[model samples]
Target: MQLKSLRMLEAVCDTGSFGAAAQLLHTVQSNVTAHVKKLEEETGAQLLERASPVHPTPAGRLLLEHARHMLRTHDLALAQLQGLDPQGASQVAGTLRIGSMETTAALRLPVLLAQLRRQHPGIDLELEAQPTAALLEALMAGRIDCAFVNGAAPHSGLQSWPVFREELVLVSGQPLTRFPTPQEFCASVFLAFRQGCSYRQRVELLMASQGVTAVRIMELGMLDTILGCVAAGMGYALLSRALVEAQQQRFGVHWISLPPGLAEEFAWVDTCFVTGSVAGWSPALRAFAQLLGIHAQAIAAGEHVRPGPAQRVHRRQAEPMPA
Candidate 1:
């Protein structure tokens, strides 16, 4: 089958409708239909079910997996060969799909992305904010080129670079003179991002450490909403100290520092830059990694360091936080 046909099939699977896939591929519906029909005939299987929000059949799912692999390999090879030219190396240009946690997207990415825009104007960057689990899933599915996620990479197919270390704090509506007892914690409600968030997991672990088991957690999507509810005495939340402190003035929320031991255990987390593998990195991705490496080196040398909510570094070495 032709690569164009496979691309049309992938688009249909992604968009879930022939017309929508045509729009996504910037082609007509008839072309998308013809390409899909060609694939079905070549494979001798009904690839898609005829229904609203169409779905791939069993055979289509199988071929889609291999199609994705082939497409990724082809793209990487083209990018690498283009970069071999001196002019192309300086003018690296491609769509770089990056996934990041909402917190990182808010606090960390602005300055870095600004620098990237200045250095490589040709690069088209698409940034998606999601929880760590979803970001990792997208990375493995070839939906994103790289991701900034909490903690180190978990899968053997991925490689991670420790980019930032954040100190988490316990936030509440009122000031706490001391740590709450297990009973006190159990009696309170907690607000956090949805289930896949790493910070939400930390909230559970922190409560369990206080010998509190069954805790009530309200899942919210936005950072502002969580802080707003916390300020209104809705519940407590575990968030980066820098993030909380930055918004404390507006939200009027109070954050308590965790005990040194607990801080070491659950408060410190590394925001890592994870990618599929070094071998598969595109020129644009390599350029982005180089920028991150420079920033990490600057942090290591304690030079040109901007100390504020945006660039909070708990440790100078940029090591991965304990799991």
Candidate 2:
């Protein structure tokens, strides 16, 4: 079958319908149907289940895995060849898909992205905000080119660079005079992002450290929502000090430092930029990584890294307490 046919098959599976795939591929439904039929005829096996929302049959799923590899190889080859042209060296152009944790996306990426746009106008950037676990999965599945995740790469196939450091704090509506006892902590609800969030995992660990075996956790999707709930005294949340302080005034929330041992063990975290093997990186990805490297270096040197406009706070109504 032709590469175009494989592409059509992949699109159909991705969009779950012939018409939707046509829309995504910028083609007519008839063309998509013809291409899919051609692939099935060539392979002598049914590829898709003709349902309302179509699904790939077992045979189709196997072919789709190979199709993605072929497509990625073709795209990477084109990008590399373009990069070799001396005339185009200054203007690296490609779509760079990035995945990041919501907190990082909110607090860290704005300045970096602004710099990237000014330096490389040809690069098209797409950013997706998810939890660290989701971002890692997206990176491995090829849905995203790189990710700003919680820690170093956990899988052997991936590589990572430490890009940012975060100090975690316990947030609440009321000021904390001292560390809460296990009984007190158990009586409170913990608000966090959905199950896959790294911060959510830290909340559990923090509770366990307090000798609390069972605790209640409320899963919320947005950072603002979690903060708002905390401000309303609905629950407590564990978040980065930078992130919480950025919106403390608006949310009327307070935060306290964790005990030194707990902070060292669970509260201090490195947000890493992770990607597949170096061989798979596109020029756009390389450029972004270089910028992050420079930022990391500046941070290491104890220079003041300015926050982007979105992160800047004009005034703070509350300050973090030492617990």
Candidate 3:
């Protein structure tokens, strides 16, 4: 059938009623009905169940699935063809949906997105903050165009590359001359994000490695809230050192690096950019990937990278620790 027919079919499936679909597609109900009817006649299969909120038949569901892929391909082609800059880079002019962890968004994306916005004024950037696991779920479901996730290994149907290596630190409200033992640390309440948070998961694993089990956890949704609780001596939290350091002045939290062995293994978390295979190579995504690649490469080459607002505060160069 025609592309317009597939668009009508998709709108119907999404909106769940002929009238709603017609309104959404900016056409009359008769046109929507006609398109679906034409598709059914051409395919010789019943397409939809005539329900209140219309349900797709098995055949309709199959076509609708392919319709989504085809539409994505069609839109991507148009964007790529029309949105190129004179400098040979993709002029990102459409919406770019990005999912990220709050920490990564806070520490890493600000500068990157600022530069992008300046370079491509036409791009409309959309951001959603979630735990890495949640971000991955959204990416897989096509809800987000790409995600900035915490350390992960390769997986099927997705591609990921390192953006930065971030140091995870144990944070507390008060400055400590001596760090607690693993058992002692586990006894303290853990302030963290919800269950799916990668930093929280790493904390659990690190504690478990020391035979610390049945630890108490407090689910604090916002980073500022969690840090506030920590400043009140509520509990300890595992977070990017950069994040804690950035707010150390406000929160008066102290950070401690992990011991050598565990630090070598779990202390450093890789922030990665992930996308599904289909959208991974989109020009908008490619531009972002190139930026990250250049940054990572510069760091790897041991160049003296100037610190930005979102930069990792190097532990070796001490800032005055908050009392």
Candidate 4:
């Protein structure tokens, strides 16, 4: 069938909603529904199972996989053709769909995006923020061009570039004088993002290492919500020090440095830029990677990213004591 129909099918499957697929495609809901229905009629099989959030049927899934392959091939062909341009200055213009973790979106991407826009005025950027695993899935499925996420770069059919290392801090509503003992730590509820969040996973490991048997976990969906809950003394959260410091005034939470042992073990997470080689390299993607390299170089040169005034004020509120 037509490539447009296949593209619509893949979008609907990825979004799990026809309406969302339409939004993604910059079309209307009825058009997305009609495209899928036409495909079903032509194939003589039902493709999607109707539900609140629809799911692809077995037949639909098979088509979706093929659709991904075809679309990736098409994108690669376009990228290669563009790369062949003798005039290199015009090669960097295209749509770049990027996925990211909420933490990175909140703390790091605004400046980078602004710079990108200024440098490549012809490029169009679309961003979606999700947990690391979800972003990886989107990248693999050709839903997004690339993703910025935490932890070691995933090895399967993907390439990764180390963007930066994030220093994590444990934050609480009440002031914590010393690092909490395992029992004390596990006593309070742990507020965190849903499953697959690297920060949540790391905190769990930290507690387990300290001989903690169990912990209470509250899964909050958004970063700001977690911060609000932690600041209200509802629970504690683990977040990038940069994020916590940036919003310190709004949340009024205290950041606790871990004991040297724990700090040494769980203090940082590497943020990596990941993309699938199967989809080939778009000029937009290459440009973004190049921009990341410039920043990574500065970090490698031992340049300290100075803390903002709010973070400086918070640090001065108490003498620096080892957790």
Best model per lDDT: 1
Ranking by lDDT: 1, 2, 4, 3
Candidate 2 segments exceeding 4 Å error: 1-89, 303-323
Q: Model 2: which residue pairs collide?
A: none
lDDT of 2 by residue, 124-237 (tens): 999999998888889999999999998777898988766677788899999998867788898889999998899999888888878877889999899999999999999889
TM-score of each: 0.67, 0.68, 0.66, 0.66
Candidate lDDT (C-alpha), each:
0.84, 0.83, 0.79, 0.80
lDDT comparing candidate 4 with the true structure: 0.80
lDDT of 1 by residue, 167-240 (tens): 78889999988877778888888998898899999888988888878988998899999999999999889998
Native-structure RMSD, model 2: 15.5
Candidate 4 per-residue lDDT over residues 24-126, each given as its tens digit: 9999999999999999999999999989789899999998999999988777556544743333335567788989999999888888888988987767999
- Least accurate 10 contiguous residues by lDDT in model 1: 314-323
- Could you give candidate 3's per-residue lDDT for residues 188-294 as a string of tens digits? 88899997899889888888877777777899989999999999999999998878888899888998888776776668766777777744456666666666677
Pick the winner on TM-score between candidates 2 and 3.
2
Candidate 1: C-alpha lDDT? 0.84
| Top-TM-score candidate index | 2
Residue 287 in candidate 3 has what lDDT?
64
